[model samples]
Target: MNLNAIKYCLRQGVVSLFRNFWLAVVTAGMIAVSLAILGGFLLVALNVGQILYNIAGNVEISVFLRDDADQELIRTRLDGLDGVREHTFIPREQGLTDFGYALGDSALFAGLAGENNPLPDMFRVRVGESDMVEALAEKMRAFPGVEFVDYGEELVARLLGVTRWLNAFFLAISFLLAASAVFLIVTIIRLSVMARQEEIGVMKYLGASNFFIRAPFFLEGMAMGWAGALSAAVALGAAYHRLAFSLQREALLFFLQPVTDPEKLWPVFAGLLALGTVMGGLGSLVSVRRFVRA
Candidate 1:
């Protein structure tokens, strides 16, 4: 508790670590591996979330206007909607042109379609909020001049559901890894304490209190936590950048831009480091308490 006691605890922790260097490294490695797995899960989940969000952003309600509908009235209706941020009117000719573009050849469709453009003129409405897109599309379905309402609401909802499940799965895995890491740390500290049981017994016989006997091991735990966490941060940061590039090669991979920037990985690294150290310190303290009390 005092300065001398604190210094003694730190010195004892250092000496004990050197004496058990191989065991300590093994323990640290286990912590690093577990933290790295958790880190990978977090990185993937975050990227998936960003990808889903981008997909949702592209979801717009297409309100198709009937040939008999008044253009001015439709414009007025769109302008009056609070959720509507902007709308682009796609005329029948424009729709035909877009359709042709998607068909591959530029001039093949131009010769065939002249008097009647079968494509419908529609308003591509961008809602202010993504969540409002569904409701706004539904409302527009019953409005005058709207022949059909189009938005991938069902797909977006399903993607969101998948994302939620992935997040939950990651959380469960993280919890299990975290518990395993703590148990390993506690076991390591306990074994170290038991190895020096004679020294602790001698100290207690010489009037050392429970706190005196426990303080050194707790400090040792804090040291192990800091080391293990730092290692994990470095390992995870390196792994994330590598995996991002590897996954980007797949054409279907979304959020490509984010996975490319390794510098943008500071948040995850810092979080993992802090988490590892805290878990280590707490686990060490827990193991030390029982021995000290005994």
Candidate 2:
């Protein structure tokens, strides 16, 4: 709490790092590995969700033509509409062909190719006035030349809804993992302090105050946490970068990129440092608690 106590703890923390170097390294390494995985995956999951959400951002409408409708008249009417931005026509034959391809090239739809295509001729339309989309779709469906209007009105909305919940779930999981790792590291530091009980007892007998006795071990613990985080970050980064370089130059990023960007390393390093510092302080506190009271 006082300057001398603080100074003493810091000095002890430095000494403890060297005194218990191996233990510190092991503890730090473990924490780093755990945190790295937790942070990396969570970051990736969130970013991927953002990408999916972005790609489906713009809305589109589909208009299916009536079997008896005049094709040219429908096209002319759709083109004359105020809200339609762009339109693509898919003949019934084209729809059947596409459906066949989608079913893994199944020959079940080959019958459609023989005589008549049963699939509806459809128009894929993008609207400039998003607010007017519903109205325009309704109008097209009501029109004599159109059979039905669909804007993927349900499917896209459902996808966005699912992703929203999934993102929250993943974030909560990541937080839990990180917290568990930190708690474990703190406990390890406490054990290390207890292992050196005799020295602490002797120091107390020699008139060392609580603060004087606690600093080094605390600092050491904190240092260990930092070291572990840093090691894990570097290891995870290297693995992710190598994988990214060797394999998916594009696709894998949609879900989770891990450590592709070097720019993100800074935040990872900062997190490690913070974790270490917290661990160190807690370890020192545990070490000095009993001695000070004694």
Candidate 3:
């Protein structure tokens, strides 16, 4: 723990990496590959979740108004609602025009459009939360001048359920991958130690404490981990940008925008780097403990 001792440990760690260059590279490669797999899954899941939630946020309640109802009174009632994010009043004429647009040939409906517009005036309400849509719709239905409310209650419920299940599934997968990565590091460190068992035994005979003997190996493992993490981050960043850029030109892949901007990627970079170091340190600790006991 003194200055000289710390220097010695640091030198030993650096020396060991070069002394076993192939092993060091192999260990680092394993960490990179494992973390890359985990990171790729996380990136995809996060983007998908964002897109789904964006769609969910757009879910709105449609409140149809009676033709004879007081429009101002209905507007006032809607404005007073607690969870409403925004509301757009759609006039009967606008509704007919939208319907004609959907039909793709506005000229096809030109004859009967004005006098025969059968659509009712509507208030389209976007709520702050998807779960609040049903409750808001119920309140809207009871308000005077509101003819009916339709919020696609069943679809909202199903979408929420799917999101919850998807989150749970991703969490489970993350834990499993993390544990596997740790175990892999442990195996790698153990092999490195086994190769240098005689040196460790000689150090023990020379009055070296367990901490003195273990610190260098632990540092070496951490170095490998850090190196591996940097590699994975660079690779993932390039791959993510390439995929995101390619998807931009394809309309069908509109919802598949992978987040590749540097600002958004900083956290992911930090997380993978930290994860690699911890796994490496843990693997070293496990190997040292087992070897010392033996």
Whose TM-score is greatest here?
Answer: 3
Q: Please name the candidate that would achieve the greatest lDDT relative to the true structure.
A: 3
Which model, 1 or 3, shows the larger TM-score?
3
Q: Write the per-residue lDDT of candidate 1 for residues 175-277, one digit (tens) a residue.
A: 9998999999999999998999999989988998887788777777777777887888787777666776677776775446454544646777788888887
Q: Residues 1-294, candidate 2, lDDT per residue (tens digit)?
A: 788777776776677677767776777767876777776675566456545544454677878887888888878888988878888898888878878889888577887774577778888888764446677888788767788888866756566667777778877877776666766666666776777788888988899866566667656766776677667767766776676666456675545443455465566556655755665556446544643465
Better of 1 and 3 by lDDT: 3
lDDT of 3 by residue, 189-222 (tens): 7877887899988988889988988998899888
Worst 10 residues of 1 by lDDT: 253-262
Error (Å) of candidate 2 at residue 24 is: 2.0
Ranking by TM-score: 3, 1, 2
Model 3 residue pairs with clashes? none
RMSD of 1: 4.7
**Which regions of candidate 2 are displaced past 4 Å?**
1-8, 58-153, 202-209, 247-269, 279-294
* Structure candidate 1, residue pairs in collision: none
